[model samples]
Target chain A: MKDKDGVSGVDSSSSGVNRRDFLKVGATAAAVAGASSVGMAESATAASFNPKKFAGTTVKILLVDGERDQEGIKDKISYIQKTHGIKVEVTALALGAQLEKIQSVLHAPTSEYDIIDNLGFTVSGVVGGGLFTKLNDYIANKELTASTYNYPADFPAGQLDYTSRYDVAKNKFGGKDVYLIPGMHSGSVIMFYRKDLLAAAGIPVPKNWDDYIDAARKLNTGGVSGTTMIAANDVSLILVDWYARFASMGGKLMSGTPGAKNYKPNLNGATAVRAVQHMIDCAEVSPKGVGSFGFTESVDAFSRGDVALMLCWSTIAGSAFNPATSKVASKIGAVQIPGDANTSGRPIRGGWGLGIPKNLPQKRKDAAWMVMQYITSAEFDKYQFDKYQTDPNRRGTYVDAALNKKYPYLKVAGQAMENAKMLDVALIPECFELVGEAAREFNLAIIGSQTAKQACANAQASWEKILKRAGHLA
Target chain B: MLYSLGISFFEFDRVAGKWNFLGLGNYKEILSDKVFWSSILVTGVMVGVALIVEVVAGVSLAIFFGQKLKGSKFVRAILITPMILNPVVVGLMWRALLNPQWGLINWFIGLFGIDNPPIWLADPKWTLWTLIFVDIWQWTPFIFVVVFARYQALPMDVFESARVDGASPLKIIRYITLPLVSSAVVFAAIFRGIDSFRTFDLVYGLTFGGPGRSTTTLSFYSFENGFVYYRYGFASALSYIMVIMATIGFSVLLKWIPVRRNH
Candidate 1:
């Protein structure tokens, strides 16, 4: 696969799937036609979708533990051995340990696992560093990928930019370069509400932040909290809760670039203060001790029928629709997050990506891509969602009429996924530090210990110091 | 240990996959960092309050259990259950019980006609206190078990002599019984103090350092920097400072609390 130059024999046929443009040509007008034209099935034209492309190789996949990333693949192990004729080994680890392992191995001369899953936030660190081989050649190589294996066209553009593509030279996400593929499941932040409660209160559904707060205040009664969110000192506090309001309200997170050394964070701006104030207002109408609520606490409260509204990652709160785990399962309705007047809802993208290491032997890299292709295909996407409830990364899966009829939230989650914005912090390695500091300061505001202005000012100060230490700021 | 000390002088460059020497830069940065100082204060308060309550409660229980009253065996066994449980589990259990809404604690207090009780995990005033209380609940039994063994092994002749010499029961207990178990009490206190000083998992499981850094102990802070932020140098420096503080604090404690093995 090697040419004179390029990362891992990357051909000159544009790093990104050119079909993205062709898919964009007709837009949603041809979505169904789009899915059918390029979408692959498990048993397709044998010449294009050969199950035995790599008949006698072993491929190992490293996946996250609790997200059910392994179950979909594990359940089909026998089929993989029989159909693909490749021995598949899967090792799943908890979040913290898995991230550490990814970092340690990404730089090794030879990678132990042929395929590794990349969390969206860690994109700038590992992928931007060019630790993974560029996959442009694989996507364009017809022999390697099936013709019916729809890629850039079938996946949402936001998820593609966030998880699949990278601009290594500029040290940012989403450019012409394609280093990874959105794998398994992808998700976005969506607003969840109680249909029963809203109907009883005669309150119209919220379309923006202003209407949202008004509805929350009016509905905060009868032993049910108006809203709950990730207000604790967790990274999700910033990524999910604060960013939803801030981005929707037209807040710009930062300016300049890391290389220019003028990267200045604008946490103390008016929009930021307003977003924080909005959360504090919601906390007033929320359950007692809402300041201490993390994802589990917030989701549990909502599922137990004590909370009237919430904004959460669909992948996580999707369980709220199951009767076995939720008292309000039948009472729930989900929609895209509300935006302010001028702008639209722009929740940050959330999901993992699958990539091959740059240092892998050529044979394994080829084998890994063959497995990745089948796994990310629209056929597998449908099966995984149908079987495991893992979120779907493909747009076609979201709009699948049959799946949407069964899981109503699929339609709303798809719309949000298309509109989702990648967290600007994901562009830098100091991301966790930046988000963590902001989460703490805002959490203090949510608890009423600090005013919204003070909290924003504090976050501003801390972020600047971190940016300066990292030499990304003057 | 030596590698951590060495790593303290260097900051890791994640993208480049190498370390850049920043000799004394990390130390200087940590010394001026407000979060580090606040964590130190939190650790100090947690260790002091939790250790004192544990020693006092444990010694009191040991003395009472030593009386060998009816069913004391079963009660003693029940009292040490928290001690045997993992610290993280203890933290999580207390967090659930202390949850302001729908928690068993609030419900129980409500039945007593106290409608408004403290929000244990949320309020800054109570978050740290709740963590300390959980620590005391889990560790006080260690002190009880250790001191009880010594209390039971004490020679009977001494107490009998004191009673024979016209000594009141309370007086004999305070003057004679206490001194004999002083060594065991001192050992348990000092040991508990060090463990409490570097406590990490409880803080991680319970508060995550806070609604606003209210419960951020030094160890947790060090871990947040090292693992969460990937600021290895800063975390290593913070850890070294903790080692120094713990070494000196325990040294002074050992000197102040004299453990007399023989009367």
Candidate 2:
């Protein structure tokens, strides 16, 4: 079977099914798709369509701990079991442990998990590794999904390209093949500001990096920092903070496409340096230890009304508008991160997806997919958002009138999500290496240890070395 | 150890889900890698400075507690409080205390009319030393507890004779007390040295080996490569190199630092 990246010659030993058998099942499944009774199972509401079809059977799922994705499942496990008659067993692990678990289990002859969640950044590594079953046939089977399920169209178009589809033949993303389903939560970096502070200081919302810096300086008084952001030794600095600024300034992330011999990071360009310089300028108006702050610290500063502005992940900073958790709950405003004349601010695409492992039995895969369909459906999307305030993945929920009224930022955040740009370098498995090297050097620049030019040059050198070692650079 | 050693010769291809033979390529690259070398230097400095400070301070506290003064038991209990806390918790506790904006440490310093204190965790120049200071605070009590027990077991006859001979307290400590506790100090040093040499969680909780990789220890560096980058072969090689360096360093330390054992 072909992997997500289109790589052939997968070791069938683990799946206990040779290529011939795999193709036979796929061909059979494809031919008999319309005749299957999976989606056609009787139900009261298509959204709550649960059947006892897999009665007394168990489907094991793996979820990332500490995320709303896991919380949603734990909250409704009993309902799922009672409705579907499929016992749901969940194994939730922290991000690192979860990834390791995926790797080890998928490689074993008989995998333990029937369903698993993949972080967006690791999609290329996990899903691309041919660990998950090709979900296109399952999705195309009308009997399994409801008429209102609207699998692909329901999710943001960009997320489907980034986190769900993989061109197995071309070994790249944006492929026609669907191997994963984007759900649980999805978000991007957006600017969050104190409306009260900005209005009091007579400063309009920043439209570009220059204006952002100017507003920060003007608002830096009265014991409040003008702005704050993640600049510490963190990958988010690269994904959420630096990349947003650099991309907004029209700096491309990669010089060449994945699998190209000349693939390298576009780190030392003029626009990249200018973006770094902008971060340094803004650092002057940030809190005293802003250089060391991550999302939590920066968001806490904004929540406590100590910072006037911030560029944060909508999922993290969403709490700032909750009365119970924030001091500025009624006083803050949200917008797309400011962009330059050449480009609109396109924050990094961020989210997670759920998929079925390829090694699972046919019955388990069906049961797991049924559970997945229920959880990611539009009905459940609205349900989760209302109950847990999860970062909504379904487009309908993002533009929901009630949600928009209660959370004023919903409309703006929805726009940001629809237009979010993913890093080109993330299409390859060497994503963390590229981002981590640049994050370290840019952090040095933000902390005043090096000039922007020097930091960019250093990052470029490191990227060159890493790409060469990864065989992406010649 | 053997499995890691085996993987050191093969490069893991994440997309292909297979391993490629690299022989000594990982080791060769790591030898010239500046970041690996810097991590080694940071680890060395952290272990050396923390070991010395903890040993010295532990002995001083041990001597003070050995005086058997009023409320000595309560003070002794307080002295070993930090030793029992997890290293990660200690790192997090100190991270808050060192926060330049609202931390108690800077606030206490501000009471003396100072403003604009240094950003301890953010500044590359001071981050390594700050980590060392935090490690010392947490582990120093381990040495004190070990040596204090030895001090309590020491016979009183020697101290009585020293005082009768008109030996001052300082002289008595320098010649008699120190010699008796040297063995305990050496034992504590070896244990603390090994523990500090492989420090990962503390650094992860504190600065995450950063600002600009200023505080990246060897273990954390290996973790970044293996888990974050998925360069299994290179990470395995790097870890083995650390093992070799630590082995040789400890061997020499055990030889050079003599501990006298009194009958």
lDDT of 2 by residue, A275-393 (tens): 88988998999988888998888888999999998998887788788888799899998877887774666678898888888888888888888888777766666667666666777
Residue A474, candidate 1: Cα error in Å is 0.2
Candidate 1 is graded, for docking, as: medium
Where in model 2 is the C-alpha error above 4 Å?
A1-50, A55-61, A65-67, A86-94, A110-112, A142-144, A361-363, B161-167
Q: What TM-score goes with each of the models?
A: 0.90, 0.90
State the lDDT of candidate 1 residue by residue for B146-209, as single tens digits: 9999999999999888888999988987899888899999889988998998899898888888
For residues A395-440, write the lDDT of model 1, one tens digit per residue. Answer: 7777776777777787677666766778887889999889989999
lDDT of 1 at A319: 77
Model 2 pairs in collision: A5-A171, A6-A168, A39-A143, A39-A144
DockQ, per model, reads 0.66, 0.71
lDDT of each: 0.84, 0.81
